[model samples]
Target: MIIAFWVSLFIILYTFIGYGFVLFLLIKIKRLFYTPASFDANLEFPSVTILVAAYNEEDIVDAKVENTLRLDYPQEKKQIIFVTDGSTDSTTEKLNRFNDVLVLHEDSRAGKMAAIKRAMPFVEGEILIFTDANTFLNDEAIKELVKHYRNHKVGAVAGEKRIFVDQTADASSAGEGFYWKYESLLKKWDYELYSNVGAAGELFSIRTRLYENVESDTIIDDHMIAMRIAEKRYIIAYEPKAYAMETASANTAEELKRKIRIAAGGIQSIFRLKKLQIPLIIRYLHFNTSVIVC
Candidate 1:
């Protein structure tokens, strides 16, 4: 009983706090003998396609389109696509109002991954960015994400997800914001140590050629897509400067529901990705941290 108790306590502590401290120490030690690579501003940028999947998000479609247009990437090299499969709202209509954006809509309500797969054939850019319809990205997001691909080994780059919480926010909102802040820090450390375990759907870009078709029913397609690339011995870089910002859930119940779904997905991913043969420490960290967070 004592042994079990001690082991359980160790896991809980390691999952929440000890891992971050360990990562910090490991990074400090690594920096002593290793020089991190720097991004070259003069390198020619590749063509990029920003793909957003929307479902009945008519109210925020216009804002998202405007935000995408305001991004700093070269207009000639950038392509914007909004997939509104199964949307019964004006999301498709509003997206159509933007001449610069391509709107793909179908009467069927396929899942998010299905929608992404449907839009894959039309992706003309060398880099494919997946983001939510409601989240807004920073102006330099595309530039920051694509710069890492200059490294041939980098298969994908994950942007940070920031939650907007005001002073009047409730406990759930504040907690969600704090959680993402901590998550962003962990991702930074993870990349420094080696590579990020997975990417968030809010804002992440991948080499179009490296993208494999994820299962159509994937609950968390972003994580799976990134992990599949990692399984191919490619690096998943994390860039904090490129971020997606969105509001917290409306209430505690909604937050709980979201987390529950994520937790379920994490469990499913564990079983599906059991073939991943990365370093044991990284695998452990990824699994435990995901379970704890959800």
Candidate 2:
């Protein structure tokens, strides 16, 4: 029992705290020998499609549309598509008013993954960027993501997710905000050492050519999409400069529900993606350790 207790304690501490320290030390050593690669800004930007998925998001769809239209990318080089599958609100009607934006919807509610799949045929851009309708992105987010594509080895780019919290925020808001800060750090380290395990749904982009149809039953679409690209031996680059801003859950209950769903989906994804799992036993240890602690 003593041995088991010690073992469990070590696992928890190492996964939650020690790993970050170890990762930081390793990154410093790596920087001594490795100069990060850069892409030339002079190269022409590829066409990109900004795909936003919404379900009963009438309240925020207009703001999201405005935020998207305000992006810094050249108008001619980018296309916007909104998928509102099963949105019972004024989301579809509001989206239709955008002359340049394409809207895809069906009366019956299918899952977000299903909505993305249904909208795929209409995507003509060389790159596909996925974002949630409730989130707002920086004006240069797309531009920052596009620059990474200059490197042929980069198959996808994961943008940072920032949660807004303040003094009046509840426990969920504070906790989630703190968690994302740590997660962002981990993603940076992952980018330097290996590839990000998955991408956050708030904002992530992939090469259109590398895009594969995600399972309609998928619970975590962003992670699955990023992992699929990683399976092909392409790196999922992380760009902290490009980020999406979103509000925290109303309270702990809402946050708990969200976490539970994600946890279930994550477990489901692990099994589905087992065939494409990273082969190194050491990598597996690190992956599961971090997951459990999180």
Candidate 3:
């Protein structure tokens, strides 16, 4: 019983705090001998497909469209697509009005993962960016994400997710925002040491060819997609400058619901990606870290 008690306590502490501390030290030590590759601004930017999945998002659709259209990237090289697979509102209609945006909608209501899969075949860009409809991107987001792809070793790039909190917010908002801030720190260190565990759904980009079709019922498509690339021995680069700004969940109840779904998806992904736990030391270490937080 005493031994078990000590084990449990150790795991609790390590999982919550020690892991981050160790990762921080490891990253600092790694930088002593390692230098990240540089990007060539003169290189021709690759084509990008900004894919958005929306369901009953009529209220924010117009703003989202405007925000995406005004992004700081070459318009000629970007293909904007909004998939409203399960929407029964004016979302499809609103999106259709934008001639430059491709709207894919169907009366049937499938999950977000299914919606993304349905639109995958139509993507014509070398880089595929996945983002939530409600979140707004910084102007330099696409540029930052695509620039990392210049490194052949990088298969995916995860943009930071920033939560806006004001004085009017409650404890839930503060806590959630603080949590993402901590997550961003860990991601930065993870990138320095190795690669980010997974990509946040708010904003992440992947190489078109590296995208593997996940299960239609997958709950966390973004995490699964980015991790899949990591499994292929490719790095998921983290870019702090490229961010998706979003508000915290409406309340504690909503925040709890979101976390539960993510936890469930993490468990599901752990089982599905067991093969990534090969005997390789570095691979096993990274996979272990992913399981704890992803």
Candidate 4:
């Protein structure tokens, strides 16, 4: 009876207080995210390289290219590179027509990390932004992300990832939407309180100097790369204005598979980066909550 009572009490304490701690941090963060800065539109835009990983993304490749070319930043200041791995379809074929975009195609599908590794040598920029072929960024995303580099202390910047809600919605869509909404809220606060624990590849930037090639089989390479930089004490800022839009994962079961894969990878990531997972030491409630969803 005593043990059972203690267990119930413990669950209650964690459910209420633990969640409250996250909320408290988020409240403090909202003030930070909204704080204005002296960022200038006329400021010199440094050269940037945007890397997109495409694996069988033929249907969306054209849209991705068109959107990247339309980024509000000056063309002379940035480059877009599409890395296609094991794209046994029209993805490579579609990329061939774009002279402005550099396309790297490999026959073997070694996964996203491998494609990124092959493309890293070709990147000629002070900063590199990693994005997915499935997501589309705001026109001002590059401009908004680059302005924070004026501080120099900021090593990486994450953007808001919005899931476009449509009329033919389903539970998977709702689940995915709810996940990112909760995620975006947490990210807004996480960066405000301190640095965001990691950056989502949907839209995130990092200094070229800090760029390190992760393992070929890396399940959550984005988190590993971003957090590795964070462990070095560099600030990973979050900008809500710089957003990326994408649809739900076709359906909930697909989203579930994605979530499960992420959760499994997250378990590996935590063990590898365990030194940084000390509760309250590093902002991980949102991250752990994400893991639980899978």
Top model number, TM-score: 1
Pull out the clashing pairs in model 1. none
lDDT of 3 by residue, 59-123 (tens): 99999999999999999999999999878889999999999999998999888988888998999
- lDDT tens per residue, model 1, 186-284: 899889876577588999999999989988888889989998888888899999999999998867888888888777777777777767744545555
The sequence of per-residue lDDT tens digits that candidate 4 reaches over residues 100-194 is: 99989879888788888899899998989988998999999998888888877888888888998766767678767776776777677667666
Quote the positional error of residue 56 for candidate 1 in Å. 0.5
Pairs of colliding residues, candidate 3: none
Q: List the residue pairs that clash in candidate 4.
A: 172-252
**Which parts of model 2 are misplaced by more than 4 Å?**
166-168, 278-294
- Assess the local accuracy of residue 107 in candidate 2 as a C-alpha lDDT between 0 and 100: 96
lDDT of 2 by residue, 161-260 (tens): 9998756668769878888889799888978987467589999999999999878888889988888888888989999989999998878777777877
All candidates: CA RMSD (Å): 1.7, 1.9, 2.7, 3.1
- In order, the Cα lDDT scores of the candidates are 0.87, 0.85, 0.85, 0.80
Provide the lowest-lDDT 10-residue window in model 4.
Answer: 280-289
Off by over 4 Å in 4: 1-38, 279-282
lDDT, residue 271, candidate 2 = 79
Native-vs-model 3 lDDT? 0.85
List the candidates' TM-scores in order: 0.95, 0.94, 0.92, 0.88
